[model samples]
Every structure is written in C-alpha cells, then in structure tokens.
Target: MATQIVTSEANTAAVPGEALEFDDIQGLVFFGHGHLKYSRYVFLRMKDGKQARARAWLRTLLERKEVSTASGKQHPGLKDVKGEHALQVAFTYSGLKALGLSPEVMTTFLQEFREGMRDERRARILGDTGGSAPEKWQVGGDATMAHVVLVLFGKDDADLDVFHASHRDCYQEALEEVFIQDADMRQGDTEPFGFRDGISFPYIKGVPTTRGSDALGLPINAGEFILGYHNAYGQYPFSPRVPRSQDPGNLLPDVPRSQRVSGEPRPKDLGRNGTYLVIRKLRQDVAGFWKFVEENSRDPDKSAEENEANKELLAAKLVGRWRSGAPVELCPMKDDPTLGADSARNNHFEFRDDPYGVKCPLSSHVRRSNPRDTLVDDPQESIKLGSRHLIIRRGRPYHDKFADGAEEQGLMFVALNTNIGRQFEFIQQTWMNNPKFSDLYDSKDPIAGDNYDPEYPGDEPKDYTAVVPGFPVRQRLTGLPRFVHTRGGDYFFLPGIKALRYLSMERTP
Candidate 1:
C-alpha cells in the first residue's frame, strides 16, 4: 500500500450506499499466536442472472472443495440451496458480528479500532504518515474497500517483541478493536513470500474505464479480470443496458449499477449482473530472504568502496523501486523521497525513459513486471499499451515477525476484473515471471522465481551482459533469490448484488 498521510475527517457527505453483494466469497485463513487466526474474504458477483447457472456453480464448488485428513474426515459440511451460479468461501475470522449490529456486545471493540485509525489520522495531522501534504497520498479510503481484510498476531513472542511493538502492533490492535465482535477475525497481510504482492490485477472489461480517479488509482472495467470476459456495453455505462424483462432482484439499480455481459442478441427474459473472483494463499520466506540478501550483496575479497556501490544498485534494480518506494522511472539516478512520496508523480513512468540502465536498470523488477512505456518505441504504441496493461492492486502486507518464523508473512494480492485469464495471469506469466523480455532469458522477477541457486551472487561483467545491440550494454544483477513464492491458489466467480437476493430464495437443486 502506498503510504498516503490522509486527513482525519469523517465522511460527512451523505452519499448513497453502494450495493455490496456477490455470488461467492473467497476467504483466506491466516494462523498465528495463541491459535489466533486472520482471514480476508473477497466477494465476487457473477455477470449472469440465470438461477440454474448460479446453482451449477455452487455444486461444482462444493464438489471440488473437499479436503480429507490423514484419516479421511472433514469439519465443515457442504450444503446446497438452489437458484445457483454464485460462489463464496468462508474462512476463519474472530469478528463477524461486530461489523454491523449489536453495539452493546461490540461497542468497546469498535471503539478501540476507531482509536487506532484515529491515531493514524492524528499521526497524519502531526505529519507522521509520510507525505508533506494530504494531496501527496491522493487515493481515497472508500475506494480502497472491496473485500473483508483482517489482521491478527500476538506480541509477546521473543522475535516479535522488538518490531512488533514498534511497527506492526498498531495495525494489529486497530483491526482487533474494529472487528471485535467477530473473535475469529485475524489480520491479513501479503503472501509471506513478500513479492511486493498485488502489483498486477485485471480490469473489468466493457464498463467505463477510469484510469486515475479520486477514489481508486484507476477504475478499470470489471470484465478484464473476472472470467477473461467483457461486459456487453464495453467502455459504456450499464444502467441503460439491462433487459426490459428482468427485475432488479434484491438490489436497487439506483445503488451501484453492476451489469452482466448482455450484448449478444438474447431473449428479453435474460437477467444480467454479476462477476467472478479468484482467491489465493501464497507464503513468503522473510528470514531466508533477509539472509540471502545480506549474504549475496557482500563481496568477500573486494574492497568496501569497490563493492558497496554495486551492491546497493543491484538491490534497487531487483525490486524495481528504491527502498523509499519510488518507482525507478522518475528517479532513475537515485531514490528521491520527494518523488516517491508524490502520488501524482511516483507511479507515472515507463522504463523506456531510462534505456541505458543508468537511473534504473532495463531489467528492473518493476519495469520488467510492468514495462509501462517500455514496449512501444512509438508514442501511439505506448498509449495503446498503457490502456491494456493497467491494473488495480488492492492488497496489504501481512507479517507475524514473532511467530515461529517457520511460515506465514506476506501479501494478500486481491484484484477484481471481468476477465481473469488475459489480464492478471498475463502480467504474472508473461511480464513478471517471463525471461524472454529480459536479456536472453537472463532476468525475471528475482523476487518471484521458484528456481533459485544458492551459489553465484554478484553483478555480471559489463562486457558479458547484453540488452541492446551496439550501444547500451547492460550488466545483469545476479545472486538474488525469488522474493514471492506461491503455495496454492484458486479461481471463483463473484455474482452481483441482485443475484444474491435471487439465491437467498432457496430453491431445490
């Protein structure tokens, strides 16, 4: 998450509530201290309105979701109620009831969470959240909320006692208070692998595309990442496109207008309004990563002056951004705290600006992952690529530093789109993990690669490295281990708010 120091003003503006219903819910389980657990549920609304279709999806979900123990038994039983085509996976959380009702049972917990946020606001007011002005952070809060995100971890562990109190404990305490009624809620972080998780996500196709609005950085069409499908009114509004024969289930069209793909000439009775969802649980290796970074960046025989500069440069390239969180495109020569902190300028560059690896290596992680303006040499090509490559990264970092350190600590990368196959995976397999884009398959996402060698750490000889022909001969940064590791993940469809009411009716399968 970009550190934006926002002002502490409650939303006094009376805005209408957005319809927040989905066909399925994908929940991630985070286990920690004192058997504490954290979970995040991503709600998906499907694009179709056929009750049978919704029911079909639920059956498939239950059938495929069985987990057998060593002795072959399970805890949660699968039950099916009709009017299907929606999917939701409920994971463990401590605070479900506290989210809405029963103030007496949860007032104190809610109050504490409120205090934590207020504390953050006060810090912002006192100039602590990092930006010089509120505008520098830019992104809005309501735009950030899409799924249920929670965090939970204990503070007394030997390793955690240090930074836990200093850095992470605040977030943990805030979440606990906010979701106090649900004792099952836990804090959610990035996948433990720590790949700057949630870099690329699919944009919904067809719906109007909002590149950089007041709320979210970019409001892409929902179709681009949901089912690898686009909505019927591509690049247009959805309110006017609904069929005349249908009723708006339990959802109000006046609320958030969620439309399904309905451009094809279909019968008038068809209903449209839903989307898809994908859930994943990825693990990160924090201890091993720090160990590797420390070991590889140092040279045994080289003088400190000779080695230190190269070491720092390589680290910067590996992450594609400086430690200050500034994208290398703008601050090519070095990290610029001012630029990194500027929302208008920080994320606004393509690696093409720095062709020679001077400010940023051609193979920098962020550049390679998001070529941005790099792919197109021509101005028109660059513009086209910008529209296609854009994605909304809505996720946060999760770390239980004091836990056994054997597992769990990273990002919970969440993205919503109409098409999943093309956008999200393309960024992962084609851009981030792909090597051909680099020099002769020499560079990939150093932080996300599965195959790693314990040996060979250092910079490639300048003469040996080659990204271009006769001019810009770049050296490759070697010895860095992949930072993000994928343990497991799955894809599910999130139906719309209207479809949700349709399913609540409970028909026989």
Candidate 2:
C-alpha cells in the first residue's frame, strides 16, 4: 500500500531575502539526509584541517545541534524529520575557491569521507554509483569544464587562473587521481532541451523566500522547503497540507507501506522545499538521428535539398518544440527563433486551442513531456493539470569530442522538482517514454522514442498515415531506427541553507 501524507497544522515563520545574505555567484555544494547529527559529522570530516576560521566555524555548528523545524513534520504527508535524510549542505563557489589547496595536491592528499576517529560510523555518502566513469567523463557545456573541474577538486582561487591557463596535464592527472580513486559527488544544471524543466521545484518551507511557481502551479512556500518555517517578514506562515486519495498501485515492491512515495507529493511544510536531483550524462547520436530522418522523409522523390528540408521537418515534429524553443503546437512549420530565444514567452503557452497535432504533433517531446491542457481539455481538468506538470530545468549541452569527429553529444539533463516521483519520473516513463498517452492512442515521443513499439507483435507496417491538419497527408518514409538511449541515474535531495550549515558541523545528535 502507498503511504498517505499527514498534513501538519503548525504555523512557521519565514526569513526575508535580506536576512538570508549569501553570494549567489560562488559555486555551492548541497547534501541532504534525515539526521542533523549525521550531517554535522560529515561536515566536520569535510572541513577537517582546513583554515582555522573555517574549522572553528564548523566546530560552532556542531555545538548547535538543533535546526528549527515546523511542527517537526515538514511536509505534512510526503516526508518527516526521522526518515527524512538531513538534506544539508551548500558551499559557495568562491568559498570553494577559498579552500586554499591546489587541485593536484588536494586530489593526492584528500582524506576519505569518513572521520578518522569514527571509522565504525561510516558516512553513507559513498554510493555504489554516480560520479565519473573511466570511459565517459562529463563536464557541463554551459559552464567551463576547467572551472567545474577545479571546483570539484577543491582548488582555491589563487591557482584557478594559472591552472585554467595551461594546467591540462596537471588538471587531468589530478582529476583522474580524485575521480578514479573514489566516487565523488557531481552536480550541474540540465541543458536547454526546449522545455521549461525546473520551474516546478517545490519551495523550501523555510528557505527560498523568493516566490516562484512550482510544477504543481502553486505559489512556493519557504516553510514547505526549509527547516525553519519562517517567512520574508520574519513571520511564521500557516498552510495546512491538503490530503488526497492514495493509490495503492503506485507503490514499488519492498517499499515500506508506512512511507508514502509517489510522483506528486504536496509541498505543505518547510523542510519539503529542497528537491531531489537526479543527473545523467546522456550522449546523443545526432548523425544517426538525422540519418533516420533522411531515409524516412515522405518526399523522397523531391530534390536533394527538398529531402533535407523534409528530414529537418520530421526532426521538428518529433521534438514537438523547435531547437529554437518554440512549441510546434504554436508554430508548426517554420521556427520562430526570436520567440524560442525569448524567456518571457518561450514557456508560456500550451496545446489547448490546438490539439489533434495540427500545430504540434501529440508525440512531440515537449507535448509528451507535459501534455499541458491537452491531456485534460475540460476547463476544470485543465485547472487541475495546470497546477501539475511544472518543472524548472537547468541543463547544458555536451559533446563527445571537442573539435569534430567522434560520437556523443546531447544534454546534461538536470531536473529540479518538489517531488521527483510525481514530476520527473512521471514525465519520463508515463509521458515521454510511453508510446501511448492515456487513451489518446499509440505514438512514440519524437525526441525519446525508446519504446517506439516495444510490444508490437507483428512486423511494423511500412504503409502508415503521417497526417497533420493543414499539411498534406503523406506516406511513411521507408525506415527509421531508435536514436536515444538511457545510460544511468539515481535520486538525490538538494538541501536548504540551514541544512548545509548543520551538515558541516557534525551536529545531528
């Protein structure tokens, strides 16, 4: 049975942005978990033998064991203080640069994550997976690889400029020393994959006084995402968790019935603000994708240039949104590069006025990812879904090789949402990965057609209807093969500011 969410009636206060003073330019490190004591212990280990002030500051945090909580039941139904991982840690980019160590030196001298004194109490931080793989190392395309590499290795600013200039040998050597020896934690935003990815992050209950829309289309509450239930005015805000019917079929085997785990958990408490981030280094087969398009164009009899145009059109249709970011549901044919690049209007529309794939095919990546108003067309249904399917995607593109030939390239797909089960996976398996969208019919997501016809018993028929309203109906082009492939992934919770402070001090108890 799926666990039910228990709404809390506690009133918590929020802290204003001014009160929470922190530099955003610096790179930050985030770690999340259930216990404050465990977090502090880890922090102590992380900061050991560092600057005296940093060490002393960490010592002070250890002494301050308790972090504020809202009714001690952060998210009324989804998670609680005990089962909840501490959900801690945030290190500024500059602060990391101030660590005062060279990447090469630190990589060689780094201590294991566990404390020397408490070897029996191993830090659960080391997972079986995540971090760099020997054959496929990754770096964010949006940010400089040198910067990220240095940050990951904990090199201070004094060495950054020199190292970045001509330390490839030193840098690569150090990176291998650290990454290859032990699995280090990795972080980065998602790429610009035409859809608004992270907009749906759950507001931290006591953090993120910055008001924003979440995937569920509701106002973000600080108390819902952080430990302390305080507001911008330094006042406690009260909002009761709204309960809904529990679906038994949603539970995975071996998952405890006592703990509710679903895709859409209500963000009703402060500590619930931090979202779990799952990062995957996916390599796209761009050449293969285009080749499939070329062979499958309806107008093969046309000139070579016409054939190429048709292939590009097919690519646009599958993605549902142009590379420029315009939704095909809105601009079906030619891309409005201006609109796609505009943040103000890029993610603002839905496929309501025009369904039936007339403008955007139902199977377009964006459309399938979030059917938006199309799935539940009725006004009331739209209202319900409007609050749902919202996510803030911060991703960057990556290529297999720097200059030219080689194979991989695509997105460093990073997605942030209040509820991973509800938002991310729901979009992946149910929408993008699923061939059939509810009762609509069978169709593969154009961008990710992994399950093009996973269960079709008969040989795929060459004759098929490729129709879109206002466009000429065409016959299916000869052949097309699956292009995308999933490499690996795991879930992680991003903690709030207070959580980070607590983690560094080794103070959970």
Candidate 3:
C-alpha cells in the first residue's frame, strides 16, 4: 500500500503542486544528516549465484525498518530531521543484474548509469587521466567494481561501530565486502583544504523544508531530483519500469496514465520517488595547494601582514569563496566571517553585477561549477537555463592514515540528480573541465579542474593558468598544479522504499 499523501505548507504556498510521498522517498534526498558526524560507505559485491540470499537480506532490512525515509518531522532552520543513525542502500548496474532483473527492464535505465563512471569514454570526459585515471583507482574500477554500497551514518564513532557491527553478518552469505570508505564532518563543516563545504543545495519543490535564500528565488521542480514527477523541462525524466506481468505482487506503483503508450499494458514504476547517486572519492593536496598559493603570492618588498593578505586573496579567487564560505563575489576586498556565517546573506548574491569577473573569476571553482546568472545576457534567463543542471550535494570530507603509513584525506563527493548526464556530467565536462569555460583561452576550474595530463594526449594545454580580472590589466597566475585528484567513484541507483520491496520479491514463473 502507498503511504498517505501529505501536502506541505511550503509547497502549497510556493507552488501549486501535488503532495509529496515522503514515506516513499529516501531521507538522504532531503537531508545530509549533518548531525550524524560519522559516516561509512561499505561497498559490497553480490556472491555468485546468491540471488535468493541477496533478496532475503533486502527483505530483512525492509521488514526491520532499518532504511531511513523522509517522513519524520522537519528540523528548524535545516532540512533534516533529528536522527541517531541513518541507513541508505543503493545498487550499481551489476547489482541490479545480480538480483535477476530482466534484460529488457535493465535497458530502460539511463545509459550513463549502465556504462558507469569508470567507462573509458566517460573517464576521458570526466578528466580522469594521469594520476586520477580509472586504472589507478583504489575502488569502483573494473577489478574493484562494487555491486552495492551501504551508506551508514551515526551521531558518533561508537554509534557507527555498533550500527555497522550489528548488521555486519546479515549479508555475509549474500555479498562479499569489496572496500570501505569512512568520512566524518570536520569542525565548522570545513574540508581537508580548510574551507567551508556543503554550503549550496537546490530547494526542491514540495520538500516541505525552509531553504530560505539558498534557492536564489527559484525552487527546482521535484522531478529534477526525484523521478515520476514533472521536471523543469515540463516533462517526466526517463525512469526504469517493469512490465505488469513481472510485478504480479503489485509491490510497485503504476505508471502514470499520461506516460503510458496507447496499446501497451501499464507497467510498474521501478524508479518512482528514486534518484541517481554519483559518488567520487576526491583526494585534495592540502600541502601542495597552500604551497602554490604562498609561492605565487610571496613578495619580499611587502610587509608580512600585507603578504599574508595577498596570499589569502589569491586562494579565495581560486576557490571563488573565502575560507569561511563567504563568496568573493559578495566581499571582494576582504574576508567577512560575519557574512560567511550568515545563512540568509551568504548565498543570496548573483554574478550579474560582477560580469567582468573582477570579484569572482570566471574560472574559479564555484563559478565554473555553477555559473549562476552569468551564462547569458539576461540574468533571469541564465538562471532558468542553469536551473536545469542543478544537483543536490550530500558529500562529506574524509581523513585517514592507512596501515601502510600512507595518508588519505579528501572529500567523498556525493551528489543526487535525476539525469546524471545532463546534470553531473555536463557540469564536470562542459563547465569545470572545459578549458574554454567563460571564454577563457586556457583555464579550467582553478581548484577542482583536471588542468593538464601529460600521459593522456588531448586538446588540454600543457600549462594551467588561473585568470583574475582586474582594473589596469588582468593578472594571470600560471604554472598551477593539479590540486584535486580522483581516487575512485561510481554511479548508483537509489531506489524508493516500495521499489526496494519490489526488487526483493521473487519473480513469478
């Protein structure tokens, strides 16, 4: 049975929309679970010929109500509800196939999800070359592919330990552990690079949470993040489905009437209220990043304080925001801790006024990731165009020193989108990795872009540059090194609650 529909006051007043099925949607879609500081991503591969055991394990999780949902009371000033622990399950293409999904139904999924993140063509487009190549990836590569990923979150390390241990043996017969990635929220939500993170998120219509000014006066359509609804393009995004015969138990929702083909039987919605998850393990070179900034900004003639200020400015221009999360576009002259901490004013500004990129450089990390009102001559038109590519980020920074005396510290870059190609890949390839973004001749995103790779030959320039627009003449900072490197990543489909139940059901002969 479907959960009772509940309309939100925010959705009712903001947009004329139908009630959202919070009970069916996963909690991670709405909440980052910031309060739960400890997180573990356990990657597993289904045991060969253990489809029945795997289905039984999923049924156990659903029956125990271990999976988190978005039905709880909303928190004040934040989108998440108070929780001691959160558990989310997602499946790779291989995982779905292991569960015995028919080939015809599998073909209905997005091509990007089918090919995966480590596909050779995808790796090239994602700039995963040189040290960041898929062959060098520690996980989610061809040899280390994971069929399933269990996202576990807890309020503390003890809580996480207990939660993980409790379920450790539940799927032992059905799955084999491939790898584990653990992450914790740093103080003040800063990443290893010492900058505030998780500052931007799209306000989904009918979500029933206060986004304040973060939405930038535009709430994205629910279908942009969730399937089975109308997207910003005024059409339903392609979602995988199953024939009615396959779902004899009626564990899934029916395909909407408008979406049904004239003579075809009504199929079951396998992707309703679900979304795609893109997870990338990005390793940041903290020492190298500061060293480059210090080396480039040093001036013997200037006082130590003046030199320090110059260094901070250069680093801020590269990141497009001060260390405290205040966008340079809002305060170009100096760092404003007050404005950075103010949620109402921090993300409320636009780049239209700084058209020349004097404040925030066109090639800066934030600017490239989200051009925001600077894509076209008309600011409103640009915002509308940009809205289509928006993604909800729900990642956390990780730090760990392995037993081999190697240190690993970076961000577990996680994002949710209905269309991985149009949203995530488009931003990664067309905006961040593209050297010609914002009309710059040879500049990529200063902080996170794949600037150059000697091993892989392409149109990428040999040298990297960070351009800063100025009054007398624009200053170009050259000889930049790759600051962020991709370690491992993959695309997974986060199914809805009912879909999980449906997937767990045995097919009728």
TM-score of each: 0.51, 0.52, 0.94
lDDT of 1 by residue, 228-317 (tens): 223323432222122322333423232222333445322111112333233333345667665655555567877887566545445555
Q: What TM-score, to 2 decimals, does candidate 2 have?
A: 0.52
Task: Give the alpha carbon lDDT tens digit for every residue of 1-509 in model 2.
Answer: 11232333441233223222121101121112212211111111122344444534433433442222222333222223343322122222223333332232123211321121112221112111122221223321112111111111212223333433342332232222111011111222223232323322333332332223222333433322222234323333221121222212221112122223376353222122333344444556677767666666656568988776666667677776666656566677777878666544555666667756767766666667766666674744663453344444533444444465654556545454444444555676577655457444444555554432222344263422233344445333322334454333223334343333322332111
lDDT of 1 at 77: 14
Per-residue alpha-carbon lDDT of candidate 3 for residues 389-480, written as tens digits (9 for 90 to 100):
99999989998787999997899999999999999999999999898888887888878898755555553444688888761247787866
What is the C-alpha local distance difference test score of each model?
A: 0.36, 0.38, 0.85
> Lowest lDDT 10-mer window, candidate 2?
22-31
Clashing pairs in 3: none
